[model samples]
Target: MSQDHSQDHSQDAGAALAEGRGRSAGARSSDQAPSLRPSLLDPLFAPARGLPGIGPKMAPMIERLLGTPERPARIIDLLFHLPQGGVARRLMGSISEAPPGEPVTVGVTVTGYRAPQAGPGKRPYRVLVEDPTGDITLVFFGMPAPRVEKMLPLGSHRYVTGRIDLWDGHRQMVHPSRIVDEAGFAALPAVEPVYGATEGLTSRAISKLAHAALDRLPVLPEWQDPAWLRQNGLPAFAEALRAEHKPDGPPPPVATDGTVPATPARRRLAYDELLASQLALALTRARSRRGPGRQNAGDGGLLGRIEAALPFALTGAQTRALGEIRADLGSDRRMLRLLQGDVGSGKTAVALLAMASAVEAGRQAALMAPTEILARQHHDRLTAMAGPLRLRLLTGRDRAAERRATLSDLAEGQVDIVVGTHALFQESVAFRDLGLAVVDEQHRFGVHQRLALGAKGQAVDILVMTATPIPRTLALTFFGDMDVSVLDEKPAGRRPIATRLVSTDRLDEVVAGLGRALQAGEQVYWICPLVAESEYVDLAAAEDRFADLQAEFGAVVGLIHGKMPGPEKDAAMERFAAGDTRILVATTVVEVGVDVAQATIMVIEHAERFGLAQLHQLRGRVGRGAKASTCLLLYRGPLGQVARARLEMMRETEDGFRIAEEDLRLRGEGEVLGTRQSGLAAFRLARLESDGDLLEVARDDARLVVERDPALRSERGRALRVLLYLFERDAAIRLLGAG
Candidate 1:
């Protein structure tokens, strides 16, 4: 670690981290401004290797910590590396009371020196230093004896900082971290920002480099509202960075539960990043889906007939969602709406009704699923609820003649709706006048793919669905560009699932329970984490469990996994769905949109291995029908704190939204299943778990800014443009009157 000799110029170093932006300039710039890079930012973007103190040997190590192959470590990138926390340079009165493993600054008198052997192995040049309480040995390795003597002449006074070690039954400090006179000790920072240092490079070195980087920063225009800053008691961008890097006082306090208070500077920087992201999304939404939309609303003929034939009435949430969709469909602006519903919330029904409206408008609609089984399930479910609307199924595995027939019928407008996987995106698949496109589990597809599907027809409205219930903060963070419609309520009479957490020591008892469940004529879903047995992970496998269950229950058991052939997988699922097989042992391949209301029992092996959202989804497979269902979470014992918390949570509640929020609290955003893959901006400075409250303010500010200055010609509008480019949201700036 670099010894902290002084804290002269580190104000801007930590400030640079306020906007944790990406590396590299974009491939193109806006024509309206022509030159995207202002001359002020050029120095900040200079390579780290070119910095004052960084040399050839240490440059690669810095790059390894910060840079990727696409971009070398730059001065700005070093600033992005924020300190983890502060370490106080505690001063001690005497050696007797000094903690053995803690850093303490102490005054001592150098007494005498003992030299190593002439030509040697492992012997050090040991010097004796004495305080009033006692004397200690300070050993220096691989140093010239004459130099060591000259540095510390007989009876010289000095201040030493570093830990004291109990080496060979004596108090010795090997190479005291810093040995300086009274002046250097006085210059030391009270609290040092602790960087996450790697081998060779120290936090001290990083701090100095950040200080150097900050010197290049020019006074920039403020993009935030002055009133909001004062109300929140937050600092400006530069002031925040300075406060973070230049640590003079004791560190900020952390809560008892390990929550760090968002110090004004940290909050300021986080708000900066959030505002940039929100503004970019607002600009894109303004330029794209706000244009004149196709009028795809029908006369409500098909929807009325379908509702009349329905077994149960739609929930209020579903009704409200449908109203929103209808309003978007009827408006002159194209619809780009996100439908977030918990498991078994009747989103499928709402989507079908939306599609039916398009059919009534004499325009065709298409639904795309992430998997073929899900597509088939949709086709089956929609066919039952579609009433007079014509529908066709398309897949890559279809026979040549039948596939051609389906395509020809679709192009000739013979089909009202087509359900398919990615095959529907093929060049050969043509639609007569595709009006509305519905994408299920949009996390599996990128935003560009969703738009590409909409591009197949003129002004095609897009409605994306997700079975995973995302917390509101994540919904805004990921789907901020689209209008949101939430199906918050379940259909009436939806069965409540009884979730049971059982230990694996009760294997025989669980099997016995399974036998009882089977004798009751209820179907079961047994989920495993792996497809095959492996010597590495000792978790249960679908194939082994399938064989064991099949032997015990005869031909009533079916097996399926991701590795199975498409047709074989289909057959296995069909057998289980049709009740030909009472039990299906499969991997998480069945986690998505494979709906079977008849299956009322879910047995997940190694439940601790799965996340909260996955466990909730697997449980959802059972509680869809009227009969009270049960979800058995089979886990092995000796659980970690997180695992035990997960199990207790699974047993406590089945509310998917509550479970989703808790999941984020437990495993954070990255490990919370499919959330991070939603094709949104990956945040470097702001974490969704803590900074979520600021997101709404940023979003509102962005919307108002876009409303007032659509072309970004005003002074603050131009500054907002810089914010967009700094955060690598350049696409939004390009949409700003490029011609």
Candidate 2:
């Protein structure tokens, strides 16, 4: 929205604007309400249904797009929903001067209306409108003639705004977006904001609601440092937000360079959101530090045994990571750290050593996985690696007798370490003295689950691990509350997989080549195209491919998919793990934490259908053992730009960190970490790709604010409290003791 457009809407909305927009003077007295939220934010936080022109029926539709189960859509949410772009309306005197496929606003008189034949399959209703220079047809499909006639009354001069296209060599417009009289046309801006539409809602309706929401903004005090705001040339909070909602002219949402215009308004608002997120994280970190940490780092007695038993030496990166994690464990402050390592970068060894450190201190440790298969895999790997400590496996699939015994052993301190799924956090399970908790694939379980596990013990140190290497920018946004440790080196004796791009046209040759791998007693993982959108389609694809491979390889081929029963899926995985089956045909269910040492060959069908990060993960499945590995990406011809780039990047480098950065550059933040899949709230205003620099500055600023005003008693500190609540970071506000 442009500034001119905002004024136009505000002019007519003055009559509807509330008399007391901000908080009353009486409400801000010394005896203010005990609520953490200030009274000034009431208007902005009001229910969207109360807005003008919004009916009860339309409220649910708005809520479906932006609401959560706990909270419905509010006026603030509508305000945050910014425009995608704008269409510039070029005022033309006549139709003859209108460019062929360009937006034009021309004054024309409605001459007549032409209705189509009454039938299911028929042409659109046409209206004849003309100027003195030339004439153009106005088309509306599936619209009643009466409505069309009423809208464009005959002999009425109106401004028609929309793109003019030469259809069948005749100048016509399928839909004239706006056909308003002179008075209505005068209110329309040259650049009209374009909004994304949802089911049962139109962009025009949303724009109206958003405009009404904007009128409720109150005068907010500046929360940012005065010197810093001047140094950055930033606008005030309300001014920046208003500028974003109302655009005036050049530099639309997307500029001609195919990049978002880093206008002053956008930069200011982006900084505001980044500041809120970073401040909340800083407060959370402060609270986490106030807890008494268990001094779990003991003399390297158990850790020495594991290191001595390993066949290969630890990488420099892994050694550095252990030093950092051990330092945190030794300090009195509670340890909340992230152990980030690329796929097969030896993170498990580091985790095992960290767990061993806790056990050496006579405290229990537990590793939680997201799935039962992963939990069991971790159990098997740890049992083989860990020779001395008593380790137990607990999962939802365990029999009642086995589960009861494991629980008894855990409570009695007989189990020194345990690996399981979310079952570890069940209320019935009690830990004698749990000193450390390591969560695998931290993106799958968010902060709530971490806190749930922490409740079982006293200040239990947490070290969440991710095989998907995250870029530094996203590291701040997702794991801002925790310290980070990255393992960048691959261990000794690990071989790089030779990646090859193959066309689907040579399917027969690829299958014949798999025969040699099978005959050599080498394990193979044959993956089908990613489940496009549904599981049923994914199941069929995997089964169909498994059938074809089974016919060729007799009984040695097995299939695994997410839809199969747990035991059945486990059986297929066990056969592949034990070398009973040489080839495993599967879907993306094997994407994460499924380790098979002998699986040397990975064949991904329709590789173009997968994202770069996913393709990298699948390739990591191989090259785990000392044997040389090969990854074949079978893609169809005429690949699109993004898909082609993904395959090329896969062939270019095996560095997961570099791949992660490229993934962020190619795609957005969502694909890099699977934000929606992980159930983590994404920043509604900040674009990580463009605003990463702001994140670093915001982080530093937040640290400074927390250090200076620990309780937020200062004037600027009080304003910052409103900033937190404005972004719905009220969870962090409650920690401030309701200033």
Candidate 3:
């Protein structure tokens, strides 16, 4: 989420712009009538033009860089856009003791100038200057000789700050970044904050905008619990913002770099943000609960039919999880729940049973998968388990007749269960009565997508399932609004996967072993990281390996990658499933939701390049069968510390939850599930790794605040509403509607 925060801020600006455009001034004022401080924060939320130093030309550029592509930039965007780092600008009188490669400010006299010769090649324009200690050259490229001479006339004094360089046994400064006279030097600070700026938007310009934003900050009330604040010694909201924007000196030596540190001031600001986020999720949950939902209870007839048909008995964890889902379905409130289970933990079985319950209630149920292949896989398995119940698969690949038939069945209440990809949410795929909507790979979809699915049927119960085991802290961060059910136990007779580490240097020996394994009538999965040859990345490709193995093993090898056509990929998988292809070479497309029961051996090439969670998932592929399975982690030599630790942990244990916690610690939250790709919330101020402790307190405080004043008309609630808007979570306020 840290990476998405910038994009989110931009979108927020765009939404604010659209909102401003649609409403008249009178309407805007009228909208603020619910609050006692009517439009008090409007000054802060106003457009960039409200800032003193920002002109019209710079406003669009600032908004382009600062705001999201959809909206205009505002004063609040500038406020949250904190500094990246600072440039220490200590004044120095001499340069003799100034070290090379370090920035130094020195005053010098303009002794002489050497202009580039007007010839075929463009040379540098050099200015010779001398200070009290020594003489140095200031080299400038692409500058006119007249301009150089005018700025540095003989005997004139100027101050400059730049990296001192020694080139060809001569002290030279290549294009000083900053140059000023005595009066300009006097105005410069000893340490200047550096900001993320575009070509037209400079750091100085952002700094000015930030200063203007700070000037307009309204004195905010303390929204935090007083005891918690006293215990933490946190500063007031306005005081924290001021201290962060205007540090007394250079920032302390902390990993915060140029961004706000976890100082009392910065932590206070972070708590405010966390509180706002939690409050928004809570409000959304509350608003959804306000809608009346139909109670679709089951008599256990359909569930018994499916479970009795199963060969193996249900695990205790599965029973508990099913009980939770059944309770949610029986209740009048809509079920917005998360079904979290690791790979091969029987999550699909539980989902099938839940859908069976929906069928027993005489309502249609739909299971949405992230991919076409996964949707088909779910359809195939559930169809087999469902016996007499009608199960249909819908995907984009369905031909006209097939698609028309499925749509007619769905809309006519003829289909009891339908499983498909995102096509389920399309406008044409109307259901007679969609009681339960089960979403697989929950993180892959966004919040609005869930809402859209819910809108298809009146108060549709949503049960999102995720194979990737998220840490407890991260689960709350991503799915705080929903009740969570964990399938901790694997099914009976499930064998523990024997994980082993091997180097790629022993390719011949490994091939010989694979030959033996194939001769023994066992299936093997050779996982590659890439599809085709990429010059930029030195990773093994599945196509090349498939070709290599085809020559050696002859038609026993099959390749499946993301670049392959949908039918080809499905064909390759089908051949592998039918034992026509004993060796399957694939990419990470096989990392999630792919279940191969006959597969007994797993080979992950360049395992060092994969994260801990992915390595765990890939390993889970082999242990599904009844036979004893082995996972060989093949890596090149010279593994990094993190990679070595990751592989070692995989070998040590197969606990998905533990691996997830370690993955969060090793890669941070951004790279684990991918902040942008998975739609994970990217926090701007608070870090999940270090700021996890604060999250619980923030959640509790937000709940208490909402509990006391659900309408948020109280004075403190008004201040908290401003906090929400500042964090781009004003949607929570709008959910309350005029109160």
Best by TM-score: 2
What is the Cα root-mean-square deviation between model 2 and the actual structure? 7.0
All models, RMSD in angstroms: 6.8, 7.0, 5.9
lDDT of 3 by residue, 13-45 (tens): 101111322221111333443332236676766
| Clashing residue pairs, backbone N/CA/C < 3 A, model 3 | 1-681, 1-682, 2-682, 10-67, 10-68, 14-71, 84-258, 85-258
User: TM-score for each prediction?
Assistant: 0.84, 0.86, 0.79
Top lDDT prediction, candidate number: 2
Flag regions of model 2 displaced more than 4 Å. Answer: 1-36, 56-71, 89-122, 125-139, 146-158, 163-174, 181-184, 199-201, 251-259, 503-506, 529-540, 636-638
RMSD of 3: 5.9
lDDT (Cα, tens digit) per residue for candidate 2, span 419-527: 9999999998999999999999877764567777877888899899999888898888778877899999988788989999999889999999999988887999988
Q: Which lDDT tens digits does candidate 1 get at residues 1-739?
A: 3121111111111111112223224122232233356565666666777888888888987877766555566666666666656656657889888878655667889999898877747779999999999988999887888988877788988888767989878998887766777787778888767676766776788888878877776677888888889998998887887777777777775544444467888889888888887887787777676567889997887788887887779999999999999999998999989999998899989999999889889899999999889999999999988888899999999999999999999999999999998888888888999999999987776555676788889899989999999888777776778889988888878878899988889988988888998999899999999999999999898999999998898999999899999999999999998999999999988997788888998999999999999999888888877788999999998998889899899999888999999987877655565543332324666667888899898889999999999887799998887776555565566567452
Candidate 1's displacement at residue 184, Å, is 5.6
**Model 2 lDDT-worst window of ten:** 5-14
Q: Write down the TM-score for model 2.
A: 0.86
